[model samples]
Target: MALKRSSSMKTQLVNGIQLQEFEQEEEINTSSSNNTPSEPAEAKAHTEPKYYTVEEAVETIGFGRFHVLLFVIMGSANIVEAMEIMLLAVVSPEIRCEWRLEDWQVALVSTMVFLGFMVFGVLCGYVADKYGRWKVVFGGFIWASYFSLLTSFSPSYGWFIFLRCMVGCGVAATSQGFILKTEFIPAKHRAFLLPLASIFWMLGSMLIIVLGMTVVPSMGWRWMIRFSIIPSIILIGLFLFIPESARFQVSAGNIKGAMSTLDWIARMNGVPLPEGELREPEVTERGNAFTLISPAYRRTSFLLWYTWFVASFIYYGSVLSSSELLEKNLLCVTDADAEHQIKHNHEEALCYCIPFNMADYQTLLISCLGEVALIPLNIALLNVFGRKASMAILLVLCAIFFMLVNICTTMFGFTVLLFLLRSVVSMNFNVVYIYTAEVYPTSVRSIGMGFCTSFSRVGGMIAPFIAQVLMSRSVIWAMSPFAAACVICAIGVVFMPIETRGRALLQHG
Candidate 1:
């Protein structure tokens, strides 16, 4: 059975996530007192009391209508987040034309967004833990969406970068969303469903492609940013519909709230609450996120952080430089239409445009199709192979495919390899989220996630610059480092001791 909070009230007060350990006592005791006191106080003192675990109950209730509804509402953030992350690519060409920006400057604008992740990740994680997950998530959505809208109005490169950085800070609530999803999901389906978040992410990227091919050619980059903000704005209004994690509420010591939350879930699933103690008495202790790296969990902590960093570097670096990679393939093939257009009106040809164009948009769209296909593949991998082994296998394969970019001189071969690499890398990254959510206890789950993500942002920050420099020389130079990183990470994942395949979320330290 998994443990949740119902520890002493003081510990709840000191807990960083503000779990409200004693908040539901009056209501719960009123109902709890009605039931006969089953165990004698003396006997209870001598042995471990029977405690109901929320994990088992959630598993029994299973996912239903409410979960699906929440999936759409809460998970919408991933789409919005993806849109912001890739939005720079959609607009960079227009921005470059207007500002007379060089390749380095355009890359800098894209890189600035992730830089915010590095600066705010740890802080945001702590806030989520100390306050509540939903608060951090709501705040992040507001910050990201508002800045994205503001960024559209930027009068200069400085303003654009600053607002873009703010967008990253706002989306730092990412860890909170992942943790919340983990809490609500059943163990058997956890790994499989978590990757669905990436599907929304891919959708966001595809939406941008549609806009770029249609909207950007006519209205402008500013309108593209504004268009992306519409979802975020609408989601903010729909925020009230999503529920707080009941597991979190119980872990915070709000037994009645937890029960009520569970009852709500049970009702949503059209089932009665399962018979079990939902929480157990715990001798609570307060600690910081550093506790994760303490003697007991240090190995798990470091390994997760290292893998997170490597995954972030490979994924972000690939995405940030994908256009240039596609451009390499584009230049290799002869396009009569592009040539004819360039011969007539150079600026009007999306394919002949200097850095990015309609050809790159088509490539991005095709790559997204491959990513979308992998949602089912990822679900199967997590179920059949489990988290760690699946990640290791995919990482090694992704590394091979990414490096093979060097040998694929023809457009078909190059594009095929790029699509495969993107798909596998997407799977690898989603596995990290599932693994991270299961690795840590609820007490510091968000913080642990945030810390690992911070490491990712560190990679996120530097990967683009590295990609930019190597890409200036050749795509081979950029891809070689990413492929090597993938190999190193693949080797590292083989050493991970935990395999979160249908296992209970590790609760106590």
Candidate 2:
């Protein structure tokens, strides 16, 4: 009786399982039949490609070997710019003697380069935005190289001024290279790496000084200018290896080209391409001068332009005034009247082709090295304090140093103050670059940078007048304005509406 009952229970259990399976199948069929119209749509949705933005793609790739390569290649732009700008300060003393130029004329040589930089600054940005970054960069390299080479062969001061101005045009165009670089860099790496890129600038500044110590003294200023062309030549070749910025390409509506470039970057970096279709960046008003002044950007633009102007004024003031300061300290001119008299006599003579001695070069080199030494500090402040605070702090410190520099009675004292001044001013400049790149959207980035840089060149255009010309008359005139400008910039920086720390870049205006 028990065996029979066990056999019946086993049968019932198997039958129950079969019934449950049948019911589930029936329910599935009923559901599928009822939802047939939506079935294909759901399947289609599953099969469709995913979309991603440029920032999303960059984040996935992260910083890799490819970025390191880009950093070096794109950072070459800073190096080249530094060499050109520093060459003015290094070579001007010699040029003055060669042409029997007055102090104002000597100042104008430096002024003209920035004049061209100012005039073409906005234009280059527009061209870069409408066209592409690499084209502008590549063309700029060519334009600058040709004109810079011609500068060495300049027969008269007028030709030299014109050629230098043309070089400035190229330099202004190349400023877009920074924008191109900023696009590729992930936000996480921006604070550290962007400030670190100033190492290239420091290297370039030092290189010109080294050449000042060696080439200008030996082969003459022409040869030094001739030799500076070599970096441009090398850079033009390296530029071939790097691709156009994917961000710019996407914003400009060349999605396929952007995808290809991104794919190449992925391959080069030993990573897989991001798993999606590259979404087109949102359409916005094409970047123009008006876009910069739009309500969205107006206050930021105003503040940023002023900040750029101040940074350039203080930085170039420190640099151009270095030679004069060194001269004053070296002469041991304790009295203000005597210092003025010495400068007057010095300007009238214009006979010493190279005013810098071995000691002067050593001092200049020491001061320049301060830029490198303080870079780690700058990076720290950027990451810790954030961009706005860092800029304001540096500007304030710069102002204090600029004022303190006025009271230095000994070479050691002046060199120390100048070193601090260069360090802070350069740090502020680095912060400004990073901040501007972050604040603007991809569509108007280059134009925004160019516009701000144009204002900087305005400061640059005027800096020589004070640094080289007025500094010759009174130290008070040169240093005081830079100090005042720094204070004003510091105050203005506090009022910026946005803080770009760890912020994702905007794709559209």
Candidate 3:
């Protein structure tokens, strides 16, 4: 009986142990079944990268040392360009004297440069948009520098026109820097920084004025042309230091290169990269001159183009006209006998060879200072009134000032009017520049600028006809059209559909 009871106990214990083992196996299987479906998803959630846009990345990086460095490097291009354009004003008379040319012929030298600028403007912008801004920019530096150096040794009037026209072609490439800068800069900082860029332009303008005062009188215009190459050479050597536009890189679908640039900007700015990969647009709009005038951008394009035309017409008109106005005021004495002598030998009496005296440089320098001084005003106007209103207001003011120039009787009064016109016109230029850059998408920004600027060159081409040619006949004739154009531009600006006051730059149309 005891043996049977012990056997029964052993059987029960084995049954319990078997039961526990089966339950444990069932639990394990259940857990595996539940987790198996979710494993890939969890892993993906943990390991997948975040995506960022160009503006987002730039916003995270913030404005810092990188931007400051960019401004100096890119702004140097502005200085060189300004000097080149201003050189035309300074040396036109010198070339006229050397070539024994008439006022109209002297005007052609200025006209030819704009012709080159206009002809190549769209092509360079297209190349920049399609290929890259950096290539067009630095390549242009080399091209412009080569042609400019050759221009110094120009043997005759024909060669001089051809070389300088090529120089304009090269100079046309330099405007890409502004587009490059617009791409990189955060929207919040554009108003202050962009208008501030005019400082470099003002510096170049004044620098050439100083050089014109010191160099041209002694060393001649050829030496002045030679001196202009120095900036290009320096920028070319520093080209490696300046990175290509990362915004441009992304738009071009160069994800790897764009990432590399962002890394550099992040490292240079001393910031961490925002989590995630840089996002590229699925379909990039390869921009051309046709894209610029497409139905979507057609209205804005036409208005902007016309604005650029008149703004340039009036700006260069004001610049070129200032020389004529100042020459008349300074050289033509107020004394009746002296005035009579001037009128009698007006062609011979005007100092074409050395038109600007020391006083003229001082006055010109002061007027240029107005561009820098009113920068704060431009910023405020841009921020407060927005682009369209500021442009219209400034344009109207510019016209009034242009008309006012006709009434000035004294040199001081004339200088003051010149200062007002320059300052207001410069403000208009800054507004239009910022407005155009903001309105266009990344794909078409450079091309759009090139197109609009080409029209500006058209105005530039015609400006000499008025400023140099018409001013020779009558100041009233010269000044009236400038005022009228300003009025026309103000009306057109008011009708502009887009006011890019605080807008993000679009990546594609």
Candidate 4:
């Protein structure tokens, strides 16, 4: 009876196990049937759509409205700075006559101004980093404007030189404005628009020439210098509308400030705010000024400094010498009093020694027409060829033209070539501003650019002296060295890497 009962229990256990296995198999089949079609459908749904945050959308819109507005304001400031720079070149003759200055003495004014720039440019850069870019820019405008206004009151050559040095100190602040622009402008537009920002420079150059021809001779050079103050006032007034750079704020670890500024930019741009982590702290430490010389940046530092020195040497040398060159070249055809008259009223002078009269509408028309034609070319080449290539080509072309100027005898030939060379060289000047802004890391970029620019001012300071001495012998011959310098610059440019181009300011290694 016990054996029969045990057998019955085992049979019941086996039946229960078989029933559980059958239920599990049925559920697995049902799950597989449901998943087979839905897998592809679910993936397809994921592929069909995506979303972006407000910040991503805003950044996609490129530069915000505020950024563009600030660029315009800063660009105007640069124009004013450029006008002051061109003023001495355009009116050197009048200033020399008024002050009874020797060639070296006349050159001292430019040199002193540049000396101030060299000393203060570095200082301003450090200040910008420590305090703020806007502060530096505003200070520069105030400083330069005050000095430029005071320049009109100078009683002697020494007094003027002292005042001009102050002006240089003020103008050194222009680099801060430039850095702010680069920091705010979007990457896609940088390569093209960065150079375009220099349109104000060209405008300033043209303004000085136009004003010199129209106003300076009539009102005297003092009034001409005074006229430069107006632009600074306009720039300062416009500054109220511009904001500090978001990137700069982020780099300084003011994340909250950065976000606030970015939100403002977005609202101005009519776009939503983005969602992302703010920029992290710079891996490299800051505070020590000498860190610019670290191993990673040493080569860049040397190359940029040398390049700035050489480029400034050539650029300022040519510009400072313009008035002296024009004076000497005109002297070949007329006497002192007659040349002065010709400068004052070229329309009335017939068969005068100078090839073209500053006052003559035809000459002005021709010069401006040449510039207009070159603008499109500059705009096209700068973007297509990139900064390095365009700069290299322009330098070589300028060198060749400078050499050709020595050989060309026909007035028409000289006029055409000279005008073209001026146009081309002016275009290259824009390249330096863009390149300087692009090459350095954000932390030291302003200082690097400012230092080089200040050194370039040194070149500017020496230019008049060199030109005066060279012109004291032969005007054409003095320019030959400029051609050689250009050749050297072309070679030096070879070491520069292809620029950031349209890319944003890059991080240092």
Q: Which candidate is the best by lDDT?
A: 2
The CA lDDT of each predicted structure is 0.76, 0.86, 0.84, 0.69
Native-to-model Cα distance after best TM-score fit, residue 250 in candidate 2, in Å: 0.9
Candidate 2: which stretches are off by over 4 Å?
A: 1-45, 281-284, 328-354
Candidate 4: global Cα-lDDT? Answer: 0.69
Worst 10 residues of 1 by lDDT: 339-348
- Which residue runs does candidate 3 get wrong by more than 4 Å? 1-43, 282-285, 330-354
lDDT string for model 2 (1-509, tens) is 99999999999999999999999999999998999999899999999889888888898888899899999998887889999999998888788778877778888988999999999888988888878889989999999999999999999999999999999999999888989899998899999899888889888888889988899777999999989889999999999988888888888888999999988888888887677788885445556678788899899999999999998988898898887666543223354343333443454554344376677788788888778788889989988999999999999999898888767466666667778878888999999999999999888898899899999999999999998778866787778999999998999999999899999999887
Candidate 4's clash total is 4
TM-score of every prediction relative to native: 0.84, 0.90, 0.90, 0.80
Model 3: clashing residue pairs? 50-276
262-351, model 4: which lDDT tens digit per residue?
777778888765444455564244323565577766665666666666566666665554455455443232223344433322233322
Residue 67 shift from truth in candidate 3, angstroms: 0.9
For model 3, residues 1-509, the per-residue Cα lDDT tens digits are: 99999999999999999999999999999998999989989999999888989888888888889999888888888888888888888887678778766678777888888999998888888898888898999888899899999999999989998898999999898888789888888889998899988889898899888888888889988988888789889988876678888888888889899899989999999998889888877436666567777888888999999999998898888888887655555223333233323431245554455366677778788888777778889999999999999999999999898887767355666677778888999899999999999999888888898898899999999999898878867777788999999898899988888888888888888
Considering lDDT, which of the candidate structures 1 and 3 is the better prediction for this target? 3
Return the TM-score for candidate 2, rounded to 2 decimals: 0.90
